[model samples]
Target: MLTNAPSVAPVPTASAPVPTDSAPVSQLAVADALMSLLRDTTTEPRPDIQLEALTLAVSADLPVL
Candidate 1:
């Protein structure tokens, strides 16, 4: 049962603030960010309608097909 692990005790520091439910970003914001990324990397015509629909569906907790 020999081990080389150190037995150092951790020092406690000030606790970080906990985020609330409201702190989460809005669904539209997330979608917008994703869209930006896609548009930057893609040269094809932007799939604005499809992307928006997907974002809305995901945000609404609806099943995507």
Candidate 2:
């Protein structure tokens, strides 16, 4: 069906930064992530350690939807 479809070239992405011997993130960032997880655990109705309810709960909680 296509008569004049142009060939698309793959775009090259920026090179990843080289990691040093030290950790990238600051200690505060790690603390923030831990706090977020704790808050989610306490406030949100977390799903149990089951395969069935897990998928449903995650889908229900999607921000895009």
Candidate 3:
């Protein structure tokens, strides 16, 4: 059974792209990438990793979207 888990803080990465105000197109790209990651179960088997990836993805794009 699925249970609600506490949100995890995003892992810091040096390579994470800095969000910019000038790019609306990249917002779609970020959303698409997030969807792709969520759909690919084989690449992200652990739920924690999935959650972290999702959190990072959304938070990164939230400012613009």
- lDDT for every model? 0.57, 0.49, 0.52
Residue-level lDDT of model 3, residues 5-41, one tens digit each, is 6533232223334444673334345555556657756
lDDT of 2 by residue, 29-61 (tens): 545555555665646676566655567778789
Per-residue C-alpha lDDT of model 1 across residues 1-65, encoded as one tens digit per residue: 34886543222222322334676444445555555556668456766898999999999999999
TM-scores of the models, in the order given: 0.29, 0.29, 0.26
| Worst lDDT 10-window in candidate 1 | 8-17
Instruction: Write down the lDDT that model 2 would get.
Output: 0.49
Task: Report how far off residue 4 is in candidate 3 (Å).
Answer: 26
Higher-scoring candidate on TM-score, 2 or 3: 2
How would you order the candidates by lDDT, starting with the best?
A: 1, 3, 2
* CA RMSD of each candidate after superposition: 17.9, 18.1, 22.5
Q: Pairs clashing in candidate 3?
A: none
Model 1 lDDT, full chain set: 0.57
Colliding residue pairs in candidate 1: none
